[model samples]
Target: MSRQFAILGLGYFGSTVARELKRHQNQVLGVDRDETRVDALSDMLDHAVIADLTDENALKELSLEAYDAVVIDVDDDLETSVICTLHVKELGAKEIWAKAHSDAHYKLLKRLGADRVIYPEYDVGVRVAESLNYHAMVDFIRLGERQFIVELVTTQRLVDNCASVANLSIDRDALFLVAIKRGQEVIRNPADDTPLQPDDSLILMGDLQALREIGRQI
Candidate 1:
């Protein structure tokens, strides 16, 4: 389903979000104080405007309440970001997402009624660290506080020890095999008798500690 969104900053992060949202067939309105930035994304977004988002009056002129969501992406200036978020919230925008540069900024945004706060750099850093720590882990997705869905490549040790899915012995209470990927073939919810092959990609969902334990053996 398509939704309407207004982005209050046209910096790299905000522009990227606008483009991606537009690509998904959503209507996106890009706003920025910098004319150059607004002009650069005019063709990419459904609408582009050069306006001072920090000015509550200017923000009110945009009819922000009509937008399904509003994104405040002024991480460079904490005060401007906070003011813009407050204005959007006061205008009764259905949802507000704000970018935070620090813990203090994050808390402020939440207090001003932001529905979501994003720390892009911090999140990317955590993902990179996870990949570096787990050599066999191809990708990782956080499912909850202590649970994750991890894509791992089967190792020689794993194949030699288990041989088949049924014979595999791990923490059944915490680990569950979700799927197996062999080249172009994907076996979803694979049967217990499924044969194991070294280097095959396995998708597993389980607790973080259990996954890490299995990671060590595999």
Candidate 2:
């Protein structure tokens, strides 16, 4: 189903989200104090407005409460970001996602009622480090404090060693093979009989340490 989103502060991060959401056929309203930024995205979003998000009257004009979700992405100006987030929350936006520059900013946003706080730089850094550490790890999603869903690219050595899911033995208490992706095909909840192939991608859910151990063995 399509959803309506209001993105405040049309900087790089906010504009990117607006464009992608618009591309996906969702209704997106892009707001920015800079006319140039709003104009640049005018053709892409459902509505592009040049307004100060921190101003309650300006926010009221947008009828932000009708938006299913609102994203606050004001960079550099932490005050503006927090104020915008608080205003959006008061406007009754169902979900609010805010970008935080630091730990303190993150906590403040959370306290202001941001449903999700994103630390883009830190997250990207962690992903880069993971990919660098494990050459075969394509991506990872943190499910909890210690659990993660990891996507690892299979190697010829791994395929030769483990012919099928049943052939690979690991601590089930710590790791679980969730799925396998080969080319465009995705095998979800693959059975033990599922054959392993070189260059295939394995999606596994498990503890971080256990995942690291599996990465080494593979």
Candidate 3:
């Protein structure tokens, strides 16, 4: 289903979100203080406007309550970022997502009614570090604060040595073997005796520490 989104600030992060949302068939409104930045993406978004984010009257004119969600990305200017978030919240925005530059900023946004506070730089850095540390981990999604669902590719050596899932030294209770993927086929709820295959991708979910220990083996 298509949803309406208002993106305040047409900088890199904001513009990227606006473009991607528009690509996914969502109605995106891009607003920025800089005319040049707004113009750059005007053709791509449903509506692109140049306006001061700190002005409550200017924000009210956008009819923010109509949007399914409003995203604020003017993190460079603390005052503008906070005021935009406050204005959006006050204007009855259904959902508010704000980008925070630091820990303090994150807490402040939450207090001001931002539904989601994101630290893009910090998140990307952590994911990059995890990928570098795990050779076989293709990708992963963090669940809450402690759990994770990870994807690990099988190697020829793993198939030869472990031979089957039963032979794998995995903490059965700590980690749940979600499935195994081989090309286009997906083996869901694979049994303990399931034979291992070279180049198969294993999907596991559980504690990050336990998953990390097994990721090393993968």
Name the weakest run of 10 consecutive residues (lDDT summed) in model 2. Answer: 162-171
Tens-digit per-residue lDDT, 39-72, candidate 3:
8998899899899999999999999999999999
**Which parts of model 3 are misplaced by more than 4 Å?**
none
Residue 26 lDDT in candidate 1 = 99
| C-alpha lDDT score of every prediction, in listed order | 0.90, 0.91, 0.91
Q: Residue by residue across 52-152, what tens digits does model 1's lDDT show?
A: 98898888889999999898898489989988988889889999999999888888899989999998777788878877888898988887899999999
Model 1 CA deviation exceeding 4 Å by range = none
Q: What's each prediction's TM-score?
A: 0.90, 0.96, 0.92
- Tens digits of per-residue lDDT for model 2 on 1-218? 89999999999999999999998999999999999999999988889999987899999889888989889999779989988888888888889999999989989999999999999989999999999999899999999999999999888998899999888765799999988999999999889889999999999999999999889867
**Against the correct fold, how does model 3 do in TM-score?**
0.92
For model 2, the stretches where C-alpha displacement exceeds 4 angstroms are: none
* The candidate that achieves the highest TM-score relative to the unseen native structure: 2
Rank order by lDDT, top first? 2, 3, 1
Candidate 2 lDDT score at position 161? 91
